[model samples]
Target: MSFTSARPEDLLIDAARRGDVPYLQQLLADGTVDVNVQNGKGFTALIVAAYDDQVEATKALLAAGADPNVQDVSGNSALMGVSFKGYPEVARLLIQHGADLNQQNGNGGTALMFATLFGRHNIVPILLEAGADTTIRDVRGLSARDLAVQQGNEEALKLLPQE
Candidate 1:
Protein backbone atom coordinates (compact mmCIF):
# COMPACT_ATOMS: atom_id res chain seq x y z
CA MET A 1 0.00 0.00 0.00
CA SER A 2 1.11 3.54 -0.68
CA PHE A 3 2.14 5.54 2.35
CA THR A 4 0.03 8.54 3.28
CA SER A 5 1.26 11.77 4.78
CA ALA A 6 -1.24 11.18 7.53
CA ARG A 7 0.74 8.10 8.42
CA PRO A 8 2.46 10.31 11.01
CA GLU A 9 5.89 9.98 9.36
CA ASP A 10 6.71 7.85 12.37
CA LEU A 11 5.43 4.71 10.66
CA LEU A 12 8.29 5.01 8.21
CA ILE A 13 10.43 5.83 11.22
CA ASP A 14 9.25 2.64 12.88
CA ALA A 15 10.07 0.72 9.73
CA ALA A 16 13.57 2.06 9.88
CA ARG A 17 13.77 1.15 13.55
CA ARG A 18 12.93 -2.41 12.62
CA GLY A 19 15.59 -2.37 9.90
CA ASP A 20 12.90 -3.01 7.30
CA VAL A 21 14.95 -1.80 4.38
CA PRO A 22 12.55 -2.79 1.64
CA TYR A 23 9.59 -1.18 3.35
CA LEU A 24 11.60 1.90 4.11
CA GLN A 25 12.76 2.14 0.53
CA GLN A 26 9.22 1.72 -0.65
CA LEU A 27 8.13 4.54 1.61
CA LEU A 28 10.98 6.74 0.45
CA ALA A 29 10.17 6.09 -3.18
CA ASP A 30 6.48 6.73 -2.58
CA GLY A 31 7.15 10.47 -2.64
CA THR A 32 4.93 11.11 0.41
CA VAL A 33 7.08 10.47 3.44
CA ASP A 34 8.91 13.52 4.61
CA VAL A 35 12.56 12.63 4.68
CA ASN A 36 13.27 15.10 7.44
CA VAL A 37 10.19 14.46 9.51
CA GLN A 38 10.72 14.00 13.25
CA ASN A 39 8.65 11.74 15.45
CA GLY A 40 7.10 12.63 18.81
CA LYS A 41 10.22 11.27 20.47
CA GLY A 42 12.28 13.67 18.37
CA PHE A 43 13.67 10.80 16.33
CA THR A 44 13.90 11.05 12.56
CA ALA A 45 14.05 8.20 10.08
CA LEU A 46 17.83 8.50 9.99
CA ILE A 47 18.03 8.43 13.77
CA VAL A 48 15.88 5.32 13.94
CA ALA A 49 17.91 3.55 11.29
CA ALA A 50 21.16 4.37 13.02
CA TYR A 51 19.85 3.25 16.38
CA ASP A 52 18.70 0.01 14.81
CA ASP A 53 22.18 -0.62 13.37
CA GLN A 54 20.64 -0.81 9.92
CA VAL A 55 23.74 0.24 8.05
CA GLU A 56 22.25 -0.22 4.63
CA ALA A 57 19.02 1.53 5.56
CA THR A 58 20.95 4.35 7.18
CA LYS A 59 23.08 4.70 4.05
CA ALA A 60 19.96 4.76 1.92
CA LEU A 61 18.50 7.58 3.97
CA LEU A 62 21.76 9.49 3.87
CA ALA A 63 22.00 9.03 0.11
CA ALA A 64 18.45 10.35 -0.19
CA GLY A 65 19.51 13.57 1.57
CA ALA A 66 18.49 12.76 5.10
CA ASP A 67 20.22 15.09 7.49
CA PRO A 68 22.56 12.99 9.54
CA ASN A 69 23.16 15.92 11.85
CA VAL A 70 19.54 16.67 12.50
CA GLN A 71 19.05 16.85 16.23
CA ASP A 72 16.06 15.59 18.12
CA VAL A 73 14.05 17.89 20.38
CA SER A 74 16.71 17.27 22.98
CA GLY A 75 19.50 18.21 20.55
CA ASN A 76 20.68 14.62 20.15
CA SER A 77 21.75 13.89 16.60
CA ALA A 78 21.62 10.59 14.78
CA LEU A 79 25.31 10.16 15.51
CA MET A 80 24.66 10.49 19.24
CA GLY A 81 21.84 7.98 19.01
CA VAL A 82 24.05 5.47 17.22
CA SER A 83 27.05 6.10 19.42
CA PHE A 84 25.01 5.72 22.57
CA LYS A 85 23.66 2.46 21.21
CA GLY A 86 27.23 1.27 20.49
CA TYR A 87 26.72 0.85 16.75
CA PRO A 88 30.15 1.50 15.31
CA GLU A 89 29.23 0.82 11.71
CA VAL A 90 26.25 3.16 11.87
CA ALA A 91 28.31 5.78 13.67
CA ARG A 92 31.03 5.53 11.04
CA LEU A 93 28.52 5.96 8.26
CA LEU A 94 27.07 9.04 9.89
CA ILE A 95 30.52 10.52 10.38
CA GLN A 96 31.61 9.77 6.83
CA HIS A 97 28.56 11.71 5.74
CA GLY A 98 29.39 14.77 7.86
CA ALA A 99 27.67 14.09 11.15
CA ASP A 100 28.99 16.47 13.78
CA LEU A 101 30.50 14.52 16.63
CA ASN A 102 30.91 17.51 18.88
CA GLN A 103 27.30 18.57 18.82
CA GLN A 104 25.81 18.51 22.31
CA ASN A 105 22.40 17.33 23.39
CA GLY A 106 19.95 19.09 25.70
CA ASN A 107 21.93 17.72 28.60
CA GLY A 108 25.12 19.10 27.04
CA GLY A 109 26.38 15.62 26.44
CA THR A 110 28.34 15.21 23.23
CA ALA A 111 28.35 12.06 21.16
CA LEU A 112 31.80 11.29 22.51
CA MET A 113 30.57 11.59 26.07
CA PHE A 114 27.61 9.35 25.43
CA ALA A 115 29.82 6.78 23.73
CA THR A 116 32.26 6.80 26.61
CA LEU A 117 29.59 6.76 29.29
CA PHE A 118 27.84 3.83 27.66
CA GLY A 119 31.08 1.85 27.28
CA ARG A 120 30.88 2.12 23.53
CA HIS A 121 34.61 1.73 23.13
CA ASN A 122 34.47 1.20 19.40
CA ILE A 123 32.43 4.33 18.86
CA VAL A 124 35.01 6.41 20.74
CA PRO A 125 37.52 6.03 17.94
CA ILE A 126 34.88 6.76 15.35
CA LEU A 127 33.95 10.00 17.10
CA LEU A 128 37.55 10.96 17.61
CA GLU A 129 38.31 10.25 13.98
CA ALA A 130 35.40 12.48 13.09
CA GLY A 131 37.11 15.41 14.89
CA ALA A 132 35.36 15.08 18.22
CA ASP A 133 37.12 17.17 20.82
CA THR A 134 38.21 15.12 23.81
CA THR A 135 38.54 18.31 25.77
CA ILE A 136 34.95 19.40 25.38
CA ARG A 137 33.13 19.30 28.69
CA ASP A 138 29.57 18.45 29.42
CA VAL A 139 27.21 20.61 31.46
CA ARG A 140 28.82 19.28 34.58
CA GLY A 141 32.28 20.07 33.24
CA LEU A 142 33.06 16.40 32.98
CA SER A 143 35.00 15.45 29.92
CA ALA A 144 34.73 12.10 28.20
CA ARG A 145 37.71 10.80 30.14
CA ASP A 146 36.08 11.73 33.45
CA LEU A 147 32.88 10.00 32.51
CA ALA A 148 34.83 6.91 31.47
CA VAL A 149 36.54 6.90 34.83
CA GLN A 150 33.25 7.33 36.63
CA GLN A 151 31.79 4.44 34.67
CA GLY A 152 34.91 2.41 35.38
CA ASN A 153 35.22 1.62 31.71
CA GLU A 154 38.94 1.24 31.23
CA GLU A 155 38.46 0.39 27.59
CA ALA A 156 36.59 3.59 26.98
CA LEU A 157 39.08 5.53 29.04
CA LYS A 158 41.85 4.34 26.77
CA LEU A 159 40.10 5.88 23.78
CA LEU A 160 40.73 9.38 25.00
CA PRO A 161 43.79 10.82 23.36
CA GLN A 162 45.91 12.52 25.98
CA GLU A 163 45.76 16.29 25.93
Candidate 2:
Protein backbone atom coordinates (compact mmCIF):
# COMPACT_ATOMS: atom_id res chain seq x y z
CA MET A 1 0.00 0.00 0.00
CA SER A 2 1.11 3.53 -0.71
CA PHE A 3 1.77 5.94 2.12
CA THR A 4 -0.35 8.94 2.96
CA SER A 5 -0.10 11.70 5.53
CA ALA A 6 -2.49 9.57 7.54
CA ARG A 7 0.11 6.82 7.82
CA PRO A 8 1.37 6.27 11.35
CA GLU A 9 4.50 8.30 11.97
CA ASP A 10 5.70 5.62 14.37
CA LEU A 11 5.80 3.08 11.57
CA LEU A 12 8.35 5.13 9.69
CA ILE A 13 10.22 5.99 12.90
CA ASP A 14 10.25 2.32 13.92
CA ALA A 15 11.63 1.41 10.56
CA ALA A 16 14.39 3.89 11.09
CA ARG A 17 15.11 2.58 14.59
CA ARG A 18 15.22 -0.91 13.15
CA GLY A 19 17.50 0.10 10.28
CA ASP A 20 14.93 -1.16 7.82
CA VAL A 21 16.09 0.82 4.83
CA PRO A 22 13.87 -0.92 2.28
CA TYR A 23 10.70 -0.29 4.29
CA LEU A 24 11.77 3.28 4.94
CA GLN A 25 12.37 3.85 1.24
CA GLN A 26 9.02 2.30 0.44
CA LEU A 27 7.29 4.66 2.85
CA LEU A 28 9.14 7.63 1.49
CA ALA A 29 8.71 6.63 -2.16
CA ASP A 30 5.28 8.20 -2.39
CA GLY A 31 6.76 11.35 -0.90
CA THR A 32 3.82 11.42 1.46
CA VAL A 33 5.58 10.60 4.70
CA ASP A 34 7.36 13.66 5.90
CA VAL A 35 10.88 12.74 6.89
CA ASN A 36 10.52 15.23 9.68
CA VAL A 37 7.26 13.81 10.94
CA GLN A 38 7.51 13.50 14.74
CA ASN A 39 5.89 10.94 16.91
CA GLY A 40 4.47 11.57 20.40
CA LYS A 41 8.07 11.63 21.68
CA GLY A 42 9.12 14.17 19.09
CA PHE A 43 11.49 11.75 17.31
CA THR A 44 11.57 11.93 13.52
CA ALA A 45 12.81 9.18 11.27
CA LEU A 46 16.11 10.98 10.93
CA ILE A 47 16.51 11.27 14.68
CA VAL A 48 15.65 7.64 15.22
CA ALA A 49 18.00 6.53 12.50
CA ALA A 50 20.85 8.67 13.73
CA TYR A 51 20.39 7.76 17.37
CA ASP A 52 20.29 4.10 16.43
CA ASP A 53 23.39 4.43 14.20
CA GLN A 54 21.52 3.32 11.10
CA VAL A 55 23.81 4.97 8.61
CA GLU A 56 21.90 3.79 5.55
CA ALA A 57 18.57 4.75 7.04
CA THR A 58 19.91 8.10 8.02
CA LYS A 59 21.11 8.58 4.49
CA ALA A 60 17.71 7.63 3.14
CA LEU A 61 15.93 10.09 5.39
CA LEU A 62 18.32 12.88 4.48
CA ALA A 63 17.94 12.05 0.81
CA ALA A 64 14.21 12.27 1.34
CA GLY A 65 14.74 15.85 2.56
CA ALA A 66 14.67 15.43 6.31
CA ASP A 67 15.51 18.45 8.41
CA PRO A 68 18.72 17.45 10.10
CA ASN A 69 18.43 20.21 12.66
CA VAL A 70 14.97 19.29 13.90
CA GLN A 71 15.09 18.84 17.69
CA ASP A 72 13.05 16.69 20.00
CA VAL A 73 10.87 17.83 22.91
CA SER A 74 14.05 18.26 24.94
CA GLY A 75 15.67 20.26 22.17
CA ASN A 76 17.97 17.40 21.19
CA SER A 77 18.73 17.32 17.50
CA ALA A 78 19.75 14.31 15.45
CA LEU A 79 23.36 15.40 15.81
CA MET A 80 23.11 15.64 19.58
CA GLY A 81 21.44 12.23 19.85
CA VAL A 82 24.15 10.59 17.79
CA SER A 83 26.81 12.38 19.77
CA PHE A 84 25.41 11.30 23.11
CA LYS A 85 25.17 7.73 21.95
CA GLY A 86 28.73 7.63 20.56
CA TYR A 87 27.68 6.78 17.02
CA PRO A 88 30.55 8.26 15.06
CA GLU A 89 29.35 6.95 11.71
CA VAL A 90 25.92 8.39 12.24
CA ALA A 91 27.47 11.61 13.51
CA ARG A 92 29.52 11.85 10.35
CA LEU A 93 26.52 11.26 8.15
CA LEU A 94 24.53 13.89 9.99
CA ILE A 95 27.44 16.32 9.76
CA GLN A 96 27.92 15.67 6.05
CA HIS A 97 24.21 16.21 5.52
CA GLY A 98 24.46 19.70 7.08
CA ALA A 99 23.30 19.05 10.59
CA ASP A 100 24.07 21.93 12.92
CA LEU A 101 27.18 21.11 14.92
CA ASN A 102 26.45 23.66 17.62
CA GLN A 103 22.72 23.16 18.08
CA GLN A 104 22.04 22.76 21.82
CA ASN A 105 19.34 20.99 23.71
CA GLY A 106 16.97 22.56 26.24
CA ASN A 107 19.85 22.29 28.65
CA GLY A 108 22.16 24.18 26.33
CA GLY A 109 24.22 21.02 25.74
CA THR A 110 25.91 20.94 22.37
CA ALA A 111 26.88 17.83 20.49
CA LEU A 112 30.48 18.29 21.49
CA MET A 113 29.54 18.62 25.12
CA PHE A 114 27.57 15.38 25.06
CA ALA A 115 30.38 13.58 23.31
CA THR A 116 32.76 14.87 25.92
CA LEU A 117 30.58 14.06 28.88
CA PHE A 118 29.78 10.63 27.56
CA GLY A 119 33.40 9.86 26.72
CA ARG A 120 32.72 9.45 23.04
CA HIS A 121 36.33 10.19 22.12
CA ASN A 122 35.90 9.14 18.53
CA ILE A 123 33.20 11.72 17.91
CA VAL A 124 34.85 14.64 19.72
CA PRO A 125 37.36 15.47 17.02
CA ILE A 126 34.87 14.85 14.26
CA LEU A 127 32.55 17.42 15.82
CA LEU A 128 35.38 19.89 16.44
CA GLU A 129 36.58 19.58 12.86
CA ALA A 130 33.00 20.10 11.74
CA GLY A 131 33.00 23.42 13.65
CA ALA A 132 31.13 22.61 16.79
CA ASP A 133 31.55 25.51 19.18
CA THR A 134 33.52 24.53 22.24
CA THR A 135 32.75 27.86 23.85
CA ILE A 136 29.05 27.25 24.23
CA ARG A 137 28.19 26.37 27.80
CA ASP A 138 25.23 24.44 29.09
CA VAL A 139 22.63 25.61 31.59
CA ARG A 140 25.00 24.40 34.27
CA GLY A 141 27.72 26.56 32.75
CA LEU A 142 29.82 23.65 31.57
CA SER A 143 31.48 23.82 28.20
CA ALA A 144 32.57 20.75 26.33
CA ARG A 145 36.06 21.17 27.71
CA ASP A 146 34.73 21.50 31.20
CA LEU A 147 32.60 18.43 30.74
CA ALA A 148 35.63 16.58 29.49
CA VAL A 149 37.52 17.63 32.58
CA GLN A 150 34.64 16.75 34.85
CA GLN A 151 34.20 13.37 33.30
CA GLY A 152 37.95 12.75 33.24
CA ASN A 153 37.77 12.13 29.54
CA GLU A 154 41.46 12.44 28.79
CA GLU A 155 41.01 11.43 25.21
CA ALA A 156 38.50 14.18 24.56
CA LEU A 157 40.52 16.63 26.62
CA LYS A 158 43.54 16.05 24.43
CA LEU A 159 41.51 16.74 21.28
CA LEU A 160 39.58 19.73 22.64
CA PRO A 161 40.73 23.25 22.08
CA GLN A 162 43.03 24.42 24.85
CA GLU A 163 41.23 27.73 25.05
lDDT for each candidate structure: 0.86, 0.88
lDDT of 2 by residue, 1-163 (tens): 9654446577798899899999998888867678789987788999889998899999888998999999999999999988889998888888988999988899999999989999988889899898888899999988999988888889998898887
| lDDT of each residue in 1-163, candidate 1, tens digit only | 9754548487688787788778888888898888888978788999988987888889888988899889899899998988888998888888888898788898889999998999888888878877899999988989899998899989987778765
**TM-score list, all predictions:** 0.90, 0.92
- Report the backbone clash tally of model 2: 0
Which runs in model 2 stand beyond 4 Å of their true positions?
Answer: 1-6
lDDT for 59 (candidate 2): 89
Candidate 2's displacement at residue 119, Å, is 0.3
Q: Pick the candidate with the highest lDDT.
A: 2
